[model samples]
Target: MILTTHILSGAALGANIPNPYAVAGLSIVLHFLQDTLPHGDYLNKKSRLREFWKVAVDLAIGLSLVTAIVFYKNWLSDEVFLTNISTGIFFSLFPDFTTFLYRYLNMKFLRPIKDFHEGLHCYENGSRRREFRIENGFWDIFITLASLLFLLFLCAG
Candidate 1:
């Protein structure tokens, strides 16, 4: 799944769930479970600079959207809410962070984490082009919209 989808989904979970620990654990678990769904995998074996730029832009956009939501929902005033949300977002992205460390930084210690992350992907069978297993069109938009709606529902109630 795209970073924006992960961010929004995690934020939605955080916004309503009162238990920070539950939010954190569930966010991480959801990250892998979502990966099992057929979604876009834009990162390819291209130029390192190109991949880095793509990730940076996506992450920037995701975080920016999260920031806007926080302000719009007046979540900043509540420290506990803020912490839970932040934890949700962090854990949700933690797997990808470990992947980056292993792939880009050669952190062999994170090999197991990276393997587990990739093992959950829809096309982990090593057949077909993994990067092109799915296109970045429908699923991204659907998940993003659904998560946004969920967040709005929680906030309104």
Candidate 2:
């Protein structure tokens, strides 16, 4: 799934859950659960710069939306809200961050974590190449839309 979808989902969890520890744990669980769905990823991209730019833009947009939502909900003054939401967002992205470190930085110590994360991915024909194709990423697009709608519902509720 795109990082934005993950962020939105995590933000939803944050907005609802009162406990930061619960938010963190559930966000990480949700991140892995979402990854178990068929989705696109930049893992196999050839150009590091291009992949970085894509992730940077995705993160920027996701964070912006989350900030807007937090502001709209008037949670800025609430320390607990900030902590919970930040924990949700951090844990949701933690898996991908570790994977990036293992892949790009050649962090050998994270090999076990990287392997475990890859093992959970739902790939077609055991091929990572298909993950970059637009046609194969319909689920990602759909989930992204669904997440946005969910957030809208939360805001209105």
Clashes in each model (backbone N, CA, C under 3 Å)? Answer: 0, 0
Q: Taking the tens digit of each residue's C-alpha lDDT, what string does model 2 give over 61-122?
A: 99998888777767788887778778878889998889888878879899998787777777
Off by over 4 Å in 2: 45-50, 124-129, 155-157
TM-scores of the candidates in the order shown? 0.86, 0.84
Global CA lDDT of candidate 1, please? 0.77
lDDT of 1 by residue, 52-71 (tens): 77778778988888888778
Give the Å error, residue 146, model 1. 1.0
Model 2: ten consecutive residues of lowest lDDT: 42-51
C-alpha lDDT values of all predictions? 0.77, 0.77
125 Cα displacement, candidate 2 (Å): 9.8
